[model samples]
Structures are given as C-alpha cells and as structure tokens.
Target: MHVLLISQYFLPETGGTTNRVASLAKGLQSKGHDVVVITAKPSHPEGVIWEGYQDDGLVRDEQEGIPTVHTWVYADFEKTLFTRLCSYLSFMCSSVLGAVRERGSFDVILAFSPPLFVGLAGWITARLLNAEFVFDVRDLWPDLAVAMNELNGPVKIGLARWLEHFLYHRADAITAATDGFCESITSITGPDTPVQRVMNGTEPEVFRRDEAGKKLRKEGGFDDRFVVTYAGNIGICQGLDHILEAADRLAEDRSGVLFRFVGSGPVKDDLQREAKRRGLDNVEFHPRVSLDEAAAHMAAADALLVPLADHEIYRSFIPSKLFDSMAAGRPVLLSVDGEARSILEDAEAGRYYPAEDGQELASNIRWMLDHPEACTEMGENGRNYARTHCTREAQAERMTAFLEELIG
Candidate 1:
C-alpha cells in the first residue's frame, strides 16, 4: 500500500506530534508499504524556522529515507486566535499544493491534527488523488480549546466544532491516539463512522538508559543531587508553575533534589519569572535540544516529571513523555489523573500526585529521595512494562493493520 502522511510538525522539530508521525512513517515503510510525508519546515514551540531550510517555496527532501515534501507555513507562536488560525490555514493551503506537486498515487492519506486544518489538507489531497482518507486525532481540538479556556464565546467554538465534524464525516476512517479520544469521536460521529485507538509510544532503543547522560549530569553539577527533569514543550497545558511551587517547598526543606526543565514554549518566560520572584534556586531551566540530547537528559535524571493542567479534557491525555520516561529506565513523578494515571499504576513505574498540587508533588519527591531502592525498582518495572506493551514498533504494526483494513 502507498501512504501519504501529513502533519504540521515533523523531524528537526522535536515534540510528541512530530515523533508519533515519524514513527508511523518508519513503521509503515518497514512493513513494505511505500510512504511519503507532507509537512512544514522545522518551526514549532518557537516561531523561528530552522537555519538550513530557510529558503523555501516548496522544499523536497527525504526523511528516514521516506520521500517527503516540506511546505510553507506562517510561523507564529503567539497565543492570539487570529495568528494561530493564520498558521493553520497557511499550512492547509500549501500542503494541498505540495500534494499536487508529488507524482505517485496514494492508497491512504493519514493526516495528524491539532490545529485541525491539516486534516482539511489531507481530505482535499485524498479527494484529488482518489485515495482513502484516515484522520488521526492526537487530541480533540475545539473541545480541548474550550476546556483550556483558549476558546470562548459560543460562535467561535461552534464554528470550530462544525469544521471538526465535517472532517470526521469525510474520513474513510478515523484513528484516535487514546481510548478517551476514540470514545469521544465515536460519540460525535455516532455508530456510522469507525473510530479506532492507535495510541502513542516510544522507541525503546532510542530512549533507553545510557552513559551519554553522564556528561550532562557532570556538567550541570547534578552528580551529587537527585535530578527530576521535565523535557518537552513548556506550554500552557503543562501547568509548570506548580513544579516551581514544589521546588519552593523542597527548598525550605533543603531536600537536595533539583527540578530541571528542558524545553521552550509560550509560558516559559512566565515560569522563569515566577521562579525568580520566589527565589527558588533549586529549579533550573534549559533550552530545548535535539532528540538524541533529550534522551540523554532523560537518562541523566533520577526521576522524570510528567505534568498537565488540571482540567477535565486532560484526563484522557497520555503524554508521549510518559512513555519516553518509562523507556529511559527512570521512575516517573506524575501529576495527572485518569487514563495516564492508569498507565503508570498498571506498569508500577511511578507514583501519582494530584494535578496542580505542589504540596503532594513535593511529598512524593521526598519519598523517592528517602527510598532510593524502591525508586530503582520502580524504574526497572517501568522499563520492563514499556518493553512489553508500548514500543513504537508494536504501535506501527497496529497502525498497519488499521490502514490495511481501511484500504480494503
């Protein structure tokens, strides 16, 4: 089968969405399916485009040896609704043009969504090429926006919902990344549309514990302290201010535990300011790094932190970072509820603290510090569970079966 994978984010842009799509592309190619990708150049969490691909009309390239096309996007990282929509719409228009430029026919066009317009691009491309369309829902958009308070007023939200509904109904099949997403999509589309859960996973070989992280540990003077790290987009959804609160509490106790944040996002400056205001010296922030560097940082950590905003919509979110932490052979300091909590509990990889509860997070951190042997055992359990249940290779095979069924 020939596949065309469309996503706004891709390699050179480090994030969960990019990794998931890249993993899917590699998995499909390994199964002997011809795969291609259509994406924007590397610009994300930050609005600036990466250096090498700056001169762009429509750049053609090979990613992981898969034929790929890079289209133009209005790179805006601002929080305003208008700028955000402009970014999504620009990509939607350019991706369709990029698809037209490509030569071969596609059996399936798999599009990832969050900005939502990418699904429109894929649907348009599928119609033009006479191919089946598979809409991949990493998160429910307008609903999440509403829950996050990013979208308000009935008119704007109503229109977004209409667009989401149109895309779902047009798809030949809809694949959700979480079970909650599947149920929600099914509820919206009714029994007529097929909604399947594909899930997000990590590549264990890429994320496993390694000696390379010792460099970061030594350089950061973390060799003697217990380092708890959060490496990903430092965006609003992360609710990272709570981590600072926890750091402040630990500072009072002189717990010898360090909180590290390694990433960039819209809210990072605010978090930094808050930490400085609180005079929390135990917390440190680093700019984002390449995937290899990120894994190394994960390896250097005594425990990995996975946090989310306290809201109803987030209960369904199983952060890709959680899987990475598990694969890195590190115990997790989780601040989430529902589905993500279930994964941690089932794997016995970590302990959960209530979302936005800094006191509890600090208490959990202290517990880990006091019981080093238990933390080591928990880390081992997480690594073993990830190896057995959630490797990217297994996820790819599951996706292959879904796509093949859709094509048939």
Candidate 2:
C-alpha cells in the first residue's frame, strides 16, 4: 500500500501531532507499506526554521525509511489571530503545490486537521489523484478555535463551520483522537461516515523510565524537591496559569515542592513573567527540550501536570501529554474535565482536578506529595495502562488494520 500523509507540522516540531504522524509513517513503512509525508518546514511554537536548516520551497527527506517532502510556510511564531491565519493559509497553499509537483501513485491520502484548511487541500489533492481520503481529526476546528476565542466574527464562524462540514463529508473515512471527537464527527457526517477513534498514544520505547531523569534533577539542584513538571506546549488552551497559581500556593514549601515547566509556546513567556512578579521561587521555567530530554524530564518528575481551560469543546479533547506521562510511569495531576477525567478515572492512572480550579489543583498536588505510596501506585497503574492500551505499537497496529479495511 502507498500512503500519502498531509500535515502542516512534522518532525523537529516536538508536539503530539508531529510525533504521532512520524510514528505512524515509520510504522507503516516497517510493515512493508510505502509511506510519504507532506508537511511544512519545522516552524511550530517557536515559529522559526531549525538553526541549520534553510527555507527551501521544497525538500525531500527520510526518517526510518519513510520518505518525506517538506514545503516552506510561515516562519513567524506570533500568537495573534492574523499571523496564525496567515500561517495556516501559507501552509495550505504551499503544501498543495508541493504535493502536485511530487505526485506519485498513492492508494490512500491521510491528512490531519487542526488548521482545517490543510485538510481541504488534501481532500482536493485526493480527488485529483482518485485516491481514498482519510481525514484524521486531531482537533475539531472552527468550534475549537471559536471556543478558544480565536475566531469571533459571526460571519467567519459560520464560514468555518461550513468548511468543517465540507471536509468531513467529503472524506472517504475519518479517524478521531478521542471518543468525544468521534461522536462529534459522526454527528456532522451522519451515522455511517466510517469514523474510528484512534486515541493519542506514546512511543513506549522512547518514553520509558530512564537514569537521565535523576541526572537532570541532580544537575538542576532539584534532587531533594518533589518535582512537579508540565512537559508540553504552554499555550492558552492549556490553562497553565492555574499551575502557576498552584505554585504560588505552595511557595512556602521551599524544600518539599518545586514546579518545573519544560516546553515552549505562546503563553510561556507571560507565564514566566507572572511567576516572577508573584515572587514564586518554587516555580522554574525551562526551554523546550528534545524528545529524549522531555522523556527524561517526565521520568524525573514526582508527578506530571495536565491542565486545560474550562471549555465545553475541551471536554471532548485529550491532551497527548497524558499518554507521555503514563508511558513514563509518572502519576499525573490532571486539571481537565469531562472525557479526559473519565479516561484517567477509568484507567486509575492519576488524580484529577476541576478545570481552572487552582485550589483543587493545589490540593491534589499536595495530596500526591504527602502520600508517596499512593503516588507510586498511581504511577505504576499509568505505566501498565499505557503498555496495555496507549503504546505506539498498539495504535499503529490498529491504524494499519483500518487502512487494510479501507483498501479492501
């Protein structure tokens, strides 16, 4: 089978979507399927090209035998609405042109959604090539953007809603990252749209317990503190200000608790400044690290934090960081609601707090700190759950089976 994957972000971007797509492409190649990824140059949260790389319009590369074609897009990392819209549009146009120029016989087209425009391009390309289109919904667009207050105009929201319907209905099949998202897509596309729930997962091999965590803790002088870490994008949707507030509450526990933030995003700088102004010595900010480094940091943490804003749309979303935390055998302090809470509760993998409830978050962290035995048990449960259901191998096998069914 030959599969063409379309996404705006890919390797070196260091996010769940990038890692998931890379893992899937490699997994398909390993199973004797030809896979090619169409993506933009590495310009994500930082919105800048990697230090050694130049913005050539199109470049061919390979990762673990899977071929990839990267196209140039926006280089700005600003969080403003206009800049983000330009970023999405730029990728949509460039990717379409790149895909056309590098046309090859493909059996199926797999495109990811968030910046929903990319899926539109992929759908058009699939139509041109007469290929099966598999639309992977990582985030419900327009609705999510609107809920986040990123798209506010009445006319613009209506147009985005229509575009959402247009893409989902046109796709031959759809795969969603959560059951809630699957339900929403089904509602939009009809009862028989062939939507599957391929929940986000982690590469167990890369996220397992490691000595690097201890080394990092020692070097950072946190060997004696109960390190609570948040290891992903520090964006608005994350609602990480709650974590800062929680840190402020625990500021007096100088030697007992420490907060570590190990990623970069639009809100990171502001969060740092807020922490500094609040005179919270317990909170520490670290720049985004490599995938391996992130795994190490997770392992070093006494617990991992997964925070989300209180929003109706977010109830259907699951943060990929949750899977990484589980794979690392670390207990999680989840500040989310609805489906995410249900998942963690069912798995018995961690404790949860109401979204945006800083008091609840603080209380949960304090409890985890005080009950070391319970914390260890929760961590063990998370690791077992990840191995049983949320590992890369498990997800890849499921995805491959789905592809086979589609082709059949």
Candidate 3:
C-alpha cells in the first residue's frame, strides 16, 4: 500500500504531532508499505526555518529512509493569531504543490491536524488524487481556539465551525489522539463517520532510564536538591505561573526542592519575567533540547511535570510529554483533570493536582520530596505501564493496521 502522510510538523521538529506522524510513516514503511510525507520546511516553536532548507521552494528530503516533500511556509515568529493563520494557510497551499510534486497515486492520504489547514490541504489533495482520506485529529480546534480566546467574532467562529464540521463530514475516516477526542468527533459527525482513538505515545527504548542525568545533576549543583522538571513547550496552555507560585510556596519550606523548565515557546519569556518578579529562586529555565538530551534531563530529575491550563477544553488533553516521562522511569507530577488524570491514576505512575492550583501542586511536591521510596516505586510503576501499554511502535502498528483496514 502507498500512503501519503500530510502534516505541518515532522521529524527534526520536536512536538507530539511530529512524533506521531513520523512514527506512523516509519512503521508503515517497516511493514512493507510505501510512505510519502508532505510537510512544511522545518520552522516550528521558534518559527525560524532550519538550516539547509532556507530556499523558498520545494525541497525533497529523506527522513529515516522515508521519502519526504518539504514545502514553503510563512515562518511566523510573532505568533499572533493572524500570523499563525498565515503560516498554516501558506503551508496548506504549498502542501498541495508538494503533493503534486509526488506525482503518484496513493492508496491512502493521512492528514494530521491542529492548525486544521493541513487537513484542509489534505482533503484537497485527496479529492485531486481520488484517494481515501483519513483525518487524524490531535486537538479539537475552534473549540480549543475559543477556549484559548484565540478565535473570536461571530463571522470567524462561524466559518471555523463550518470548516470543522465540513472536514469531519468529508473525511473517509477519522482518528483521534485521545478517547475524549474520539467522543467529541463521534458527537459532532455521529456514527456515520468512523472515529478511533490512536493515542500519542513514545519510544520506550529511546526514553528508558539511564544514569547520564547524573552528570547533569553534578554539573548543575543539584545533587542535594529534589528536582521536578517540565521538559516540553512552555506555552500558554501549560499554566506555568502556577508552577512559579508552587515554587514560591515551597521556598519558605526549606525542602531543597527545585522546579526546572526545559523547553521553549511564545510565553517562555513572559513566564521567566514573572518568575523573576516573584523572586522565585527555586525555579529555573533552560532552552529546548534534543530527544536524547531530554531523556537525560528526565533521568536527572526526581519527577517530571505535565501541566495544562484550567480550561474545559483541556479536559480531553493527555499531554504527550507524559508518556516520555513515564517511559523514562520517572514519576509524573500531573496537573490536569479528566482523561489524563484517569490515566495517571490507572497506571499508578504519578500523583495529580488540579490545574492552576498552586497550593495543591506545592503540596504534591512536598509529598513527593518527603517520600523518596514511594517516588521510586511510582517511577517503576510508570515505566512498567509505559512499556506494557504506551510504546510508539505499538501505536504505529495499530495505526498502520487501521489504515490498511480502511483501505480494504
């Protein structure tokens, strides 16, 4: 089977959607299916195109032996809603040209969505090629945008809602990243459209426990400190201000607990400013690192944090970072409710605090700090659960089978 995968993000761009699409492409290829990727040039988070693909035209590249087509994007650094839409729209238009450049019929066209324009482009491409179209939803947009206050005005909201419904109705099949998302899709399009939960997972082997983090601990003078690290995008949805407040509350306790952030996003600078203003000496920030380096950071920390803002739209979100943290054999400090909280409790891998609740977060941190043996047990439980249930290879194989079944 020949599969054309469309996404705004891909390998070398570190995020959940990129990881999901890349894993599926590689997994399909490993299973003897031909996979072709249509993605934008590598500008993400920072919005600066990576080196070697600086030209304003189509670039053909190979990612782990899978054929890929890189198209031009707007590369918006400002991150305003208009600029972000321009970025998504530019990729949406260019991805069609990239698909045209492929010049081959596909058995299936799989599109990943967040900006949702990529799904629009994939729908267009599928229609042009008369192939089966599968819409892979990572987030429920327009609803999420409205919750974030990013999409407003009746005309804009009406159009976005129309587009969302249109894509859901038009797709040959739909795959959601979470069960909540599955339910949401089902509610929107009803039983006519097939909706399956294809969870975001991690490569357990790549993220397994290691002592490499000891070197980091020694270098950073954190040998005596109890470290809790948040090692992904420090975005608006993260509600990191609560973490600062937690740190402040802990600062007076003299527990030697430190909070570390190891990623980048639009709100990173603002979060840093807020931390500094609040005199949060226990909180520190680092730039984003590669996946390998991220594993080391996780290993060095006593616990990993997975937080989401307090919003109803976030109830469905299982932050993809949680899997990697668990796979790395570290206990998680999960601060989200609903589906994610359920998973954490089921795995016995972590403790939860209500989102945006500094007092609760601080209390959890204190408990984690006080019970070292319990934390170790939690870490072990997490790793075991991740190995048994959340490997990326398993998810990819599941997705591949789903696609093959759809094709059949």
Candidate 4:
C-alpha cells in the first residue's frame, strides 16, 4: 500500500508527536509500503525553522528511508493569536497545494491533528486522489482547546465542532492515541465510526538504561545529588510553575534534592523568573535535546517528573513522558490525574500527587529521596510494563492492520 502521511511537526522536533508520525512512516516503508511524508520544514515548538535548514520553498528530503515533501509555513510559536493563525494557515494552504501537485496515487492519506485545520487538507487530498482517509487524533483539538480555555465564544467553538465532525464522518478509519480519545470520537461520530487505539510509544531499541547513561550524567555536569528531571516542552499546559513552587518547599532540605527542567517553550523564561524570585538554588534548566538524548537524561535521573495543567481535558491526557520515563527505568513523580494516574498505579511505576499541589509534590519528592528501595522497585516495574505492552514496532504493526482493513 502507498501512504501519504501529513503532519505539521516531524522528526528532530522534540515531542511524542514527532516520534509517533516518523516512526510509523519508517515502519510502513520497512514493510514494503511506499510512504511519503508531507510536513512543514522542521520548524516546531520554537516556531522558527531548524538551524541551517531554510524554508525557501517546497523542499524534498528522505527521513528514515521514507520520501518526504516539505511545505513552507509561517512557522513561529508567537503568543499573539493572529501570528499563530498565520502559522497554521500557511501550512494548511501550502500542504494542500503540494498534495494536489504531487504526481501519483496513494492507497490512504493519514492526517494527524492539533491544528485541526490540516485535516481539511487531508480530507481534500483523499477525495482528490480517490484514496481512503485515516484521521489520527493525537490530541482532541478544539475540545482540548476549550478545556484549556484556549478556545472560547460560542461561534468559534460551534465551527470547530462542525469541522471536527465533518472530518470524522468522512474518515474511512480513525485512530486515537488513547482509549479516552477513542471514546470521545465515538461519542460524537456514534458507535459505528471505525475508531481504534494506536497509542504513542517509543522504540525500545533506542531508549534504554545502560552504563553509558551514568557516564552521560557525569559529562553533562550532574553529580551525586538526587535528581528529579522534567524533560519536554515547557508550555502552558504543562503547569511547570508548580514544579518551581515545589522546589521552593524543599529549598531548606539538606538531602540534596536537585530539580532539573529540560526543553524550551513559551513558559521557560517565566519559570526561570519564578525560580529566581523564590531564590531556589537547587533547580537547573536546560535546553531541549533529541529523543535519544532525552532518554539518556531520564535514565540517569533518580526520578522523572510528569506533570500537566489541572484541567478536565488533561484528565484524559496520558503524558507521553510517562511512557518515556518507563522506558528509562526511572520511578516517576506523577502530578497529574485520571488516565495518567491509572496507568502509573496499574504499572506500580511510581507515586502520584494531587494536581497543582506543589506541597504534595514536594512531599512526594522527599519521600522518593528517602525510599531508595521503593523507587528502585517501581522503576523496574515500569520498565517491564513498557517493554511488555507498549513498543513502537508493535504499534506500527497494529496501524498497518487498520490501514489494510480500511483500504479493503
């Protein structure tokens, strides 16, 4: 089968979305399916194009053995609404034009969403090529936006719902990253809508704990202090300020608990300011690294920090960081609730704190520091669970089955 996979973000962009899309395309290609990935030219969370990579026009490249089509987008993670809209719109218009111009036929068109407008292009492309459409709901878009208070006003919300339904109804098959997402789509599109759960997972072969991880910590300036690490986009939905506040509560502790944040986003500067204001000297911040690098840091840390904004939408969000943490064989300090909590509790992976409660998080951190035996056991359990159940190779095979079913 031939596939045209479309997403706004792809490899080298640090996030679960990047891993999910790129890994699947490569996996399909390995299985003899011709896959062409259409994406923006590497500009992501920061919004600017990747260094040394200019987006002058449509660029062609190969990513993990799969052919790639790069479209120009007004990419920038500007705070203003207009600027962000332009970023999304440029990608949508350019991708549609590129899809139409590309010569050839495809068996299926897989569309990933967050900037839901891109689904329109996917639907259009599928119709244009008379191909099947598969919508991958990685994030429940406008609904998630509404819960995060990013989207408001009845008019806009109504239109977003309409768009979402239109695309879902048109899709020959829909795959969501979690059961919560599957339920959400089924509720809207009815029980008959073909919805499956193809969770976000990492390549186990690439992410594992080894002696080199310990060497990495020493080389990266980390020492014997008990380290609690949070590595990902420091965006608003992350509620990273709570982590800084938690650090404040432990400021006087002589146990040598060090908090480290990795990755860049809209709120990195503010979190730094808040940490400084509180005079917390134990906290350190680092820029984002590639996926393998992130795994190395996670493996080296004594414990991993998994947090999310305290909101209804986040209840359904299983932070992809949890899966990565498990792969690193580190006990997690989970600060979110609902689906994420269930996963950690069932895996016996780590302890959880009340959402948005820095004092609770602080207490949990201290507990994690003192109970080395428990942490070690929890980390082992997490690693076993991740290896046994969730793996990139397995997810790709499941997705392939869905494609074949839909195409037939």
Q: Write model 1 residue lDDT over 236-338, tens digit each, in one string.
A: 8888888988898999675688988998888999999999999988989999998889999999999999999898889988998889899999999898788
TM-scores for all predictions: 0.97, 0.97, 0.98, 0.96
Q: What lDDT score belongs to each candidate, Candidate 1 first?
A: 0.88, 0.85, 0.89, 0.84
**Quick one: RMSD of model 4?**
1.5
What would the per-residue lDDT of candidate 2 be over residues 73-192, giving only the tens digit for each residue?
A: 878877788988888898888887877887568899899998898899889888878889999999989888988889999899999999999998999999989998998888889987
Which stretches of candidate 1 lie above 4 Å from their native place?
none
Q: Poorest 10 consecutive residues of model 3 by lDDT? A: 204-213
Please rank every candidate by TM-score, starting with the best. Answer: 3, 1, 2, 4
Residue-level lDDT of model 3, residues 254-280, one tens digit each, is 559888999899899998999889988
Query: Which 10 consecutive residues of model 4 have the lowest summed lDDT?
Result: 203-212
| Residue-level lDDT tens digits of model 4 in 56-139 | 778887777668888888876676667767877888888888888788899999999978878887888899899998899888
Deviation from native of the Cα of residue 98 in model 1, angstroms: 0.8
* Candidate 3, residue 10: lDDT: 92
Candidate 1 Cα deviation (angstroms), residue 377: 0.5
